[model samples]
Target: MGFKSKRKIKTNFVSAANKKLRLAWDRKHRQLTVSDWRKWVFSGKTRVNMGGSDSESFYWSDVPGTNRPHQVRPQVQGISDGVMVWGCISGDRPGYSTAIIDGAIDSNKYVEILKTSLMQTLE
Candidate 1:
């Protein structure tokens, strides 16, 4: 099966496709806005705020004390998936966002996309 055809896509236009997917992820999600897709990226996964101190912002800690920081939190990832509005900006209002977050969170497709995106970006 073709890599892309395996997916059920709508409005099959490259220029608008990415935007559509992003908006889809924004409509249903409550925390991470469509603008925060960067966090779902593998590069961002390791760098996002896990949970350390009670600072206003996300911080990374590698200390050997009682308050050692954790830089990796799957809950954040779950939140990312939950708040994902997969296909937005296609509704009424013409630039409207979607509320669909039906992507396989831990499926091969998820891994493949992230791996592919990471390779292209990091490599």
Candidate 2:
């Protein structure tokens, strides 16, 4: 036995915590399958008078003009994929970067997490 030092479980715990943080930022992190983003034809009435009316097929970015203050709208012209991730994170640290340490989001890891969470709810 050529063991150098004692195995620290706290160190392992901290490592796991860091991974959970990466997961939070990856909630909207999805790979773009195509080189360019998809764009809608957008050929219709330029201005739509909602007039406080509710519609199922409406988006905030649909408004072409930027008049609202503190309202930085995304150019929906570039339709990007926004996937949902059921992971935890420390906080909104910006940059939205996720680190999948040693292929963390593999099929096995996903299945294991699902099983564990499901088991908890059953109890």
Candidate 3:
């Protein structure tokens, strides 16, 4: 047996429709200049696991190949076991972040985060 211990690759399931939409979006913006891209601020939210990720998993593969179905772990987004935070970055510098101590962010909370973190980042 050629089985070897390896860390499973984490991935999210993307619907066919979403995949097509992503391709279309990519095509639409493929010609964007660096300056055009620089004008945009990238922002996102993520969960910072306190101890470690509960989703960490391992797999065995005899065949040494990349992205085999068995080696790919499908991750489903759910309530985080630790803190959630929002942050952003421009072309030049990283932006401020807001840690969610309470829980999930509602619209009001999102607005407040933007008002404070994002606003401060822009300044």
How does model 1 fare in lDDT?
0.41
Candidate with the greatest lDDT versus the true structure:
3
Off by over 4 Å in 1: 1-63, 68-80, 86-94, 104-123
Per-residue lDDT over 1-123 for candidate 1, one digit per residue giving the tens place of the 0 to 100 score: 655424343444566788888888778775765657443432211112334322333444556444434444333444443333222122122222223244434466445544554445433
Best by TM-score: 3
Q: Give the Cα-based TM-score of candidate 3 against the true structure.
A: 0.69
Ranking by lDDT: 3, 1, 2
Q: For each candidate in the order shown, give its overall lDDT on alpha carbons.
A: 0.41, 0.39, 0.84
Error of 2 at 70 (Å): 10
lDDT of 3 at 71: 78
Residue-wise C-alpha lDDT for candidate 2, range 1-123, written one tens digit per residue:
997654343333457778888887566445533332232111111122223222323235556777665353333443332332333322222112222233226677556654664334333
Return the clash pairs for model 3, or none: none
Candidate 1 vs 3: which has more lDDT: 3
Q: How far is candidate 3 from the true structure (C-alpha RMSD, Å)?
A: 9.2
Candidate 3's residue-wise lDDT over 42-90, tens digit each?
9999888765676755776777867888677655466445888999999
Show the lowest summed lDDT stretch of 10 residues, model 2: 39-48
